[model samples]
Target chain A: MTDLKLALQEQAEDVDKVLDDLLLEPEGPEAQVVKAMRYSALGGGKRVRPFLVMASSRLFGVSEASALRVAAALEMVHCYSLIHDDLPAMDDDDLRRGRPTCHIEYDEATAILAGDALLTLAFEVLADEETHPSPSVRCALVSELAKASGMNGMVGGQMIDLMAETRELGIPEITRLQRLKTGALIVFACKAGAILGKAKDIKMQALRNYGHDLGLAFQIADDLLDVEASEEETGKKVGKDAERGKATFVSLLGVERAREQAHMLSEQACRHLDVFDRDTELLRAMAQYVVNRRS
Target chain B: MTDLKLALQEQAEDVDKVLDDLLLEPEGPEAQVVKAMRYSALGGGKRVRPFLVMASSRLFGVSEASALRVAAALEMVHCYSLIHDDLPAMDDDDLRRGRPTCHIEYDEATAILAGDALLTLAFEVLADEETHPSPSVRCALVSELAKASGMNGMVGGQMIDLMAETRELGIPEITRLQRLKTGALIVFACKAGAILGKAKDIKMQALRNYGHDLGLAFQIADDLLDVEASEEETGKKVGKDAERGKATFVSLLGVERAREQAHMLSEQACRHLDVFDRDTELLRAMAQYVVNRRS
Candidate 1:
């Protein structure tokens, strides 16, 4: 694989270790549920959002541990969203990442509780003083994640997506929906790292813009891949969007235009890195990787 | 209505007003979700959890406004649980408080998002500095809520409940489950008030015990009502436990024995309040109401 692929894999492994360590505890009555949570959470994935957090935190020359909790927390919130999103009432996809969804592996009720446990656990992880030394910083992290994950952010976007599936949506409406649904957490992942790294105010703001743009680009690329990539390549069922008649960027703008938009957004995201002169190669590469990713 | 009934009605009205004012915001994409959330949270009910928080805070000489956010937050978490519990995969109850449940009123997906929103909003309300002046105190409050609402707490208990419904449960096992599921948050409610009010450590522990015992008693009484009360009187469908074939306190301990257990638990809870030299009249009255109320 390329150096970029190796770096992504390494970061994914590191974040996977962080997730496993954070999820461990002595036995309890609900140990089974905790085990179920770990089963879903620690199952290997790309770990893109956590990587963004770490990469952004590195930009400000901060220690990796300071952002580890936030990184894991982002993954927690993301995993929780995926768990719920894959439920029968939501996207109803049985397979995710080459495996059965949480609800498919566990009962739906267990899946629901597992998702709830993960979401609440994210706050608990952030609020732990041993993990996050600064109360203000912890609060900031919590606020950011809450805003991204809640109705006004990821969940709101999801509602719109659900509605848009039943009816055709224009480009503007689809973009707005994807921005909230998929992009909100992406922006949050970068902001989480920026907060932990204590980046300069101007740099932080620019990073926010970068994340917002990258998030949209990432979703567009995902939409494009859903239409273009094979199931084996994507590790997700291909053409399910078309089957459901969902309003995705590719569905609205076609594969060609969506690819162009992803490229443009990636450039916009990389432009924000110019504000930071130190250790930005990873950030720039990540922006490129966002659009170039096959899965 | 008696004097106690009149007082409860007034308290309920005041809480509704506070809820309306707190949830009110400018119209936007989030407005509809927020509206559904407010509609689920603000309607008529006992508001027992918030009352516990408010009354306990009063015991420690905190202003109502000081505890308002905590009160509202406790209610939000409670409402979220009810909403999720009413989902198709869970208990699938159609009616709550004499009206269609959130899932019944809205689609299951909307109800899911609505519950998720309320849970996130609980933390947002607590984090709002206007309501909670001390970041440290707010942090503690957030941590406490997270613990109560997460694994080894409410969610854990719910999982155990779901599992136990398929089989028999001994008294100790039932108590343990109830303690985590129902009792943990109730205990946290009282303890959170003590923390916010800056009460003495000894008082905090005592009030926590009080809340814990009260939670068990309250749950037992609920089980009793499920077996004995009518739908009109309780505002919930009667004999749901029997219909669902779930093991409740009444199912395990039988009706008379469960009532005796509830009485014993309430007495123990009231005994904990003896550590504080204050008018715990509301506390005592609430304990009595728990056992005696038909609905």
Candidate 2:
């Protein structure tokens, strides 16, 4: 790994610790749900979303601690999505990040409640006095996060994915599906940090575009990994999408074509960072990291 | 229905139209997910949560329009909980409010996504400038909604219910479960509107207590109806809890005893409302309405 990559990895660890700290629920009637939420949220993962928030905020000269809450908030939503996605009703997966899924670890009802709690907690974290100092900026973050996570964003994409499972999907259809399902929150993560960091409107737009491209690239890479990675490497069952007849880039496009598409998207994503100053080496590295990472 | 009930129902219908108007998705790839969200959300049902918000705000002399978005938000979270609860892995119910459950009507993935979207949108509605004037108020509202909806609140209660499915639960355990699961949000709904209406903190606490008693009464009545009401009247399959071996008040205390308990809770809710002055007639009536409603 390059020095930038190594530094980000360290920061990623810090982000994970911070995320765990924020998710700790007070003892109460809902303590079990809180425990389930913390279990899934604190489970080991790449922390890519939080990384993006911190990295993007760094571009605008904001301290990592200043963006920490928003970073944790992004991870909370991501974790919630994963837990729900792993439910018997959704993707029906039994394992996630190399462990029994939330529903399997806890009961399905607890898993559902856990996901719900985490999603609500994300907004609560963002609305905190420390993370959101200015009402206008906080409002902007709330709107952006909502639009990205809501029906017109991540949830929408998942719906299309469900519909596409039994149907033949074209490259355009697949891209569109991934954009909403996967890309929306990644973009939102960056944009939310930018809003908190008080980046100029134009710069925020550029970072958003960067996130948008990066998100798509990440999705394409995930498709690639599903075919190439081992269970140990990906920490998930590989080739399950193809086995399930789920429409994915590699299944729709040949492996060679999918690899080429991922590269093209990564280049486009990196180009978006040109709008930012040299301090955005972190963003550029993230683009390259998306396509190159083994998992 | 009484004259007041008829008028409240008409107002609820108008509010339902507003809900439909507000939920239309701006065009994007996420439209279908938004559509499913709209389907489950706008799917015909009693707008009780919104009614509580509107009624509580009205108690404080705020116009319905001023509390319009807050009302919608309360409904959104309520709808979200219902959708998630109806999942195959959760309650596994096939129907809600006399309609096919979200997971049943629109595939499981779509239902999960729809519920997730609605939960996020609640905060979005609060944060919008169109809803309230002050960010501080919006911030408080967001925090209130989140705390009420998350672990130690609705979701937490759900976890307990799931865990206690076969295990015997006493009155205190059952009461605690119901209080967190249903009572918390209703309490927050009243408190939220009162906060938006700028009610003093002491008044807000009293209204919240009123909501708490009403919520408990509502749950006990629901437990009663599960035993007494016909499937058509209740819009839910009768004897579900009994079939599932679920512990319920009626199951624990017998039917007549459960009815008495509900009456006591409703009366307690009314006594809490004595502090609200003459304008609290509607709020008091709502408490009685909780125990008296057939469905």
Residue B228 lDDT, candidate 2, scale 0-100: 86
Q: TM-scores of all models?
A: 0.96, 0.94
Model 1: per-residue Cα lDDT at residue A86: 88
| Tens-place lDDT digits, model 2, residues A179-257 | 8888999998778667887878888888888888888889889998999999999888889898988878888888899
- What is the C-alpha lDDT profile of model 1 across A36-124, one tens digit per residue? 78878888778899888888888777678877777888888888889888889988988888888898888888888888888998888
- How high is the CA lDDT of each candidate model? 0.83, 0.82
In model 2, the runs with Cα more than 4 Å from the true position are: A25-30, B25-35
Evaluate candidate 1 and give its CAPRI docking class based on DockQ: medium
TM-score of chain B of 1: 0.95
Write down the C-alpha DockQ for each prediction.
Answer: 0.61, 0.63
- Interface root-mean-square deviation for each candidate? 1.9, 2.1
Model 2: docking quality category: medium
Clashes of 2: 0
**Residue B142 C-alpha lDDT in model 1:** 81
